[model samples]
Target: MSVKPASSNRPLSPFMIGPYYRAQLTSMLSITHRLTGLALAFGTVFLAAWVTAAAAGPDAFAVFADLANSIVGKLLLVAYTWAMLYHLCNGIRHLFWDTGRGFEMKTAYASGYAVIGASVVLTAAVWAFALLV
Candidate 1:
């Protein structure tokens, strides 16, 4: 005789199941840090292409420059800038954790927020400087 397994009632996707399923700052920061790392990896391909274009000569470099100066490219640059800043700040937070520090819940949460705040402030400051100069 074949028997079916009994199922207990529980959400397979905790995120969608309840209003109280809100993500904690630490978890969100962890996911964001990993995502930003991946984004930087992908952005590196563009960086390599730009360098190759420069080596190829003025015409190729000009094409690369024009594309980078376009609106979509500007948006990608902004995203890459933010990702770099976020990854840098989060990496420092991870370093502190590596030293066996900031394990307290309050400290961890505060550091997570600090990383996010620093990334936004630094990214905006860089863009502002770029635009004004």
Candidate 2:
């Protein structure tokens, strides 16, 4: 008879998933901002659809508009907006580095945190305004 491996016979223990060491904060945030930006770009398809449908005729616009005003649409709008803002700020930071600024380790770290902080602040601000007004 065939026997299972020793490891397979026993129940599995706690498992760690995802990159730990490789996901150093800087690298993690950098990649995430880029990804979010890419997602936001795709989200723009809805924007184009809205504009096109609105221009096409009133009936088409009403349908698209109703969907856009729904809960899921609002959430997507908020997320896409924030993603755009974060990507923009981080991109500016990267551009600065490309221009030979903020290159020193200390400066780079400071700017990285600055981008994170700024993104959070801007994203919250947009939502706050969106909600309040």
lDDT of each: 0.90, 0.81
Give the per-residue lDDT digits (tens) of candidate 1, residues 1-133: 8665565455564355237656778877887888899999998999999999999999999999999999999999999999999999999999989999999999998998899899999999999999998
The regions of model 1 sitting more than 4 angstroms off are 1-22
For candidate 1, give the lDDT of residue 107.
93
lDDT per residue, candidate 2, 1-133, as tens digits?
7887778866442232253234456776777776987897798898899899989999999999888789998888888877888899988987887887777778778888888899889989988997899
Q: How big is the positional error of residue 92 in model 1, measured in Å on the Cα after superposition?
A: 0.6
Scored by lDDT, the top model is 1
Clashing pairs in 1: none
TM-score of each: 0.83, 0.76
Question: In angstroms, how far off is 7's CA in candidate 1?
Answer: 18
| Model 1 residue-pair collision total | 0
In candidate 1, what residue range of length 10 has the lowest lDDT sum? 9-18
